[model samples]
Structures are given as structure tokens and as C-alpha cells.
Target: MASTRTTRLDRKQVIDTALRLLNEVGLEGLTLRAIAAELNVKAPALYWHFKDKQALLDEMATEMMRRMGWPSEDQSADWREVITAAMQGLRAHLLRYRDGARVYSGTHFTDTSYAGPMETFLARLTTQGFTPAAAVRGWHTAYSYTIGYLIEEQAMTGRTFDLTARAERLADHPLAAQAGEEMFGDYDAGFDRGLRAVVEGIGATLRAPGAPGKGRGEARA
Candidate 1:
């Protein structure tokens, strides 16, 4: 019962179909068979494009990066500004699909399309007095925070919570109730504040005595 259109199926076609199906079925329900059905192809036809579910996910993450566009080539901005913008943009893109953060985490990219932009970003950091290793670490920290935040955020989506009721129920545990209240308030402002702390923490590391460049503007005269 395969459609004639199935014969024209390509990798992009498969990945695109998978992404579309992702929002509908989410990461747990999205399977090669589902994508194949959506594309009007047999499950085997999908295997021809992706060897397995993980392979498809890897490529899907790659496609997500492509859609996210790249950091600007302009290096005039401070490294902290660059990290904030990039992480915030990543959060927005991950919010676009159900389980998007899950799909992106722990998946290897299937292509080198990310390399050029990453190189540019690293170069920007180095010019701002980050050692190559420090630049890599800083980026990883920010990336980890963004991914972790979205994972929790997506998991909580559409779930009705009665924070006040919970707090009253936990009135015996005053600190726990207060913590829960704080955790549920204004995720946007919380994310911004947390990201600022991350950037500032990294900046502190770089400025510590004996650190590379010693200071942001002190990069090897």
C-alpha cells in the first residue's frame, strides 16, 4: 500500500517527516514505523534512510541546529553577550517541539555543518581572553544548563499545579514549601538570572589570578 511518492524519499524527507511527527507523537511515541507511515512508505524504507531510531534522532538534532541558524560572524560583542544570546536562542528552539530537549540531548550530530560556526565562536572567546580549553568548558557549561532547563520545562508543560495547595500541604516543611514556590515562579526571569550567574561565574574563573589572560582585556599584549 505504499504510495508512489515513497520512491522519492530522501534523508531530508525522512528527517523532516520525523520532526513533524515528533510534535504529534513526542519522543517516546516517535518511531521509524511512525515516520514511515507518515511518509507513506514502509518501515524498511525508513531503515534505508536511518539505520535505527538513534540514527534518526542524531540527524534530527542536526536539523534542529541548521534551523537554529548560526552565531553572527561579528566578533565585536563580548563573549558573555554571545553566550547569553546563543543559550537563550537554543532554549526557544527546544521549546518549539514536544520532547525537543530530550531529542537533542546525548545525540551526536550526523554532519559537520556545526563546525564552522563553532570555530567562529571559539575564536571569538579566545579573542576575549579565554584559553581554548576555557572557551570549550564555558560553552559546555552553558549548553548543559540550557538543555537541563528545557528538559524540566518540557516535562512540566500543560500540567496543572496548585502551588498554594502544595505549600499548605507541606506547611510542616517550611523550607521545602518555600523552595517549591520559588521553583515555580516566573521561569523566564529565573532562566535569565540563572544564565547571568553562569556567565558571571565563568568570567570570574577567567579573571582569577594565574588564569589565562589574567583579565578580559589583558589578553597577551
Candidate 2:
């Protein structure tokens, strides 16, 4: 039997091995058997730590969140700044791994481990005077927007179209054609502008009197 220290090391090794495999083979290729083989361990040993493949995936997602410093200790910033920075950090982290957004989208948040960032976000929003329900809604809105935007941004990168191609395609719409060149010229700026707009809109909604209270009850931990 492995010592407790050895067991912990083995679990970390298995998870790290799985992450590397995920990066190399994409989510579809990640599996317990594959990870065990990569870690030079038996599949049964992995199962000892993870009930099944989904459990492993959940652990992987949780690990990814930890890597990004979710549940941040710093509470110095206002809600808007904190949320925006968190979203931006999420986008950057997703961009770091292939098919990262897909992985994140599929992961469940019912697990408190997976809900750390969200809990922190809602707590901040509620502190800023948002109702619990409003804070939850706002958190979901920002999260959805960030993930959706990142998906679109990643998809755009895979396209072959350049400014000239876009310009020609939009020639019938003269104004659009002119805008295409400038749009393509500074795509990063456009991304930031869109993010800023979303954050500002959410902020405005929170600031409005009677917009909505956090909701009828207290927030869940």
C-alpha cells in the first residue's frame, strides 16, 4: 500500500498527466486509461481517486481555475473592476489551452470547488448593493458574455479572411467596406471595446435605482 504522501503525489501526477494529455489530444482524447498509461499507473489506481472520467474532468477544471487564481484574496477593487479583471483573466486563460472554452462550457458549477470565482463575484456585487438575485444574474451575464466573446474571437482567428478580403466581401455596403479595414487593423481594440461596453452596461444596470434587488433571499455560499 502506498503511504499517504505517496498517494497524494500519485494523485497530483495523474492529474498533471491528464492535463498534458488534454492539451495534446484535446478533451475528446482525455481518458482515465490514457492518463494512467501516461502516468505509468494502473487504471484502478486512478479510479481510487476519481470515481470516473467525469470526476477527472471536474478535477481538471477545478485545477485550471486554481491556476488562474480564482477566489482572489484581494478585495481592494470595486465590483466592476474586480469582475472585469476576472473575466479578462478567464479569457486569457481559456486562450492558453486548445479548446479551453469548450472544456469550461461543459464543466458543472454545482461543485463548490468550481464555483469559487462565481461566489467571489456575487459576493462583491452584493457588497456593492446588488440584490442576491441581481448579483447572480449579473454574474451569469458577465460570464456568458465573456465566454461567448472569447469563442467568437477564437473562431475569428481560425478564419482565412484578411482586411482586403473582408473589404471586398462588404463592397456592396460601402460604409461597411470602409469600416472593415479599420476593424481588422485593430481587432484587439475592438475586443476590448466590446468587453468595456458589456461591463459598463452591467454597471449601469446595477447603479439604476429599482433596477432590481439582489433578490428575495440571501446569496448561497
Candidate 3:
């Protein structure tokens, strides 16, 4: 039988090893045996805590969430400021590990334990005068946009193509050329702009007259 401290240390070791593997080899290359090998433990020992690879991945995702500092309770800060901080934290966390966004996007965790950040988002939206349904939609829209943007950003990590040259080529198409220039000059600024746009657009829609009910119906129309 293992001592309590030994068991605790083993669990941390497994999770730490898994995170390293995630950064080094990505989600696809991560496995129970691989993690065990990395930690010099038997594969069955890892299974003692995590039932399977999916379980391990879920644990890893949970670990990632904790690292992101998702708000546990309402902050005294402004709604937009709090929500934006959470989103930016997620973006930074995803960028920390190779293909972190891809790993996160592929998994689904619907239980309350898995939705801390989203719960915070919904609460913020509601406090800002959005109805429940509107708040939910706003949360989804923000989450989708953030995840999609991060995935694209991660995918572009190793490209050798010249974005400026591409922009010059697209000069024949005026709008495309302008977009290319925007893309080439400070990509991080572009992401921040898009994030603000989505959040502000949701706020505007929620505030519009008869929007709580009417806007949702019209949006579906």
C-alpha cells in the first residue's frame, strides 16, 4: 500500500507528465502508457486514478481550467472587464501549450464543474441586463469565436508564407487587400478587435428595443 503523500505525489506526477506530453507531442500523441513511461510508473497505476485515456484527458482539461484562473465567484469589477479578462486568460493559456486549443475544442464537458468560466460569463451578461436566453446566446457566441480564433492562430504557428506578399497579390481585390494588410500588421490586435466586436455586438443586440424576445426570433428567421 502506498502512503498518502506518495499517492498524492503520484497523481501530480501523472498530470504534470501529461501536460508536458501535450506540449511536446500534442493531444494525439498523448496516452496513458506514454504518460506512465514519462513518469516511470506502470500504466495500470495511472488507471488507478484515471479510468481511461478520455478520463485522463478530462483531468488534463480540468487542470488547464484551474491554471486559467476562471472566476469562482462574482468579482467587484465591471462586467465587460471581468469577462474580457477571462477570455484573454483562456487565449494566453491555449497559446502556452502546442495545440492546446485543439485539445480543448475536441472535448465536451457539460456538467457544472466543467463550466466555471462560462457560468461566470452568463452571470456577467445577465447582470448587464441581458435576459437568460440572451445571456446564453452571448456566452455561446463569445466561446465559439474565441475557440475558433485560437485554433486558426495555432495552425499558423509554423508557416513560412509571406503575409505581406499575399496582401500585395490580393491588392487587385480591394477589400481582400485591406483585410490582408490588417492580418499582416499586428495579428494580436486583430484578435483583440474581433473579441471586442463580438462582445459589443451582443451587448448592443441585447439593449435594442424589444430585443430580448424579438431579436432572437428574427435572428432565427
- Top model number, TM-score: 1
Q: What's the candidate order when arranged by decreasing lDDT? A: 1, 3, 2
Model 1, span 68-177: residue lDDT tens: 96667877667777888999999988899899999999999988998988898888788877888989999989999989988988888888878999999999999999
**Tens digit per residue, CA lDDT, model 2, 1-221:** 64222333356677778777877877778888788767666677777788888778777776777678564655444666677777878888888776677667766542466566666677777766677887777777888987887666665665666778777888899898898755556656766777778777776675445433332232422
Q: Assess every candidate by TM-score.
A: 0.90, 0.72, 0.76
Residue pairs in collision within model 3? none
Residues 64-177 of candidate 3: C-alpha lDDT, one tens digit per residue: 776776655753345555556767778888889888887777665423575656666777666656778987877777778888988888887777667678878887887887
Candidate 3 TM-score, true structure as reference: 0.76
Candidate 1 yields a Cα-based lDDT of 0.84
Number of the top lDDT candidate: 1
- The deviation in Å at residue 177 for candidate 1 is 1.0
Candidate 2's error at 103, in angstroms? Answer: 0.8
- Candidate 1: where are CA atoms >4 Å away? 1-6, 207-221
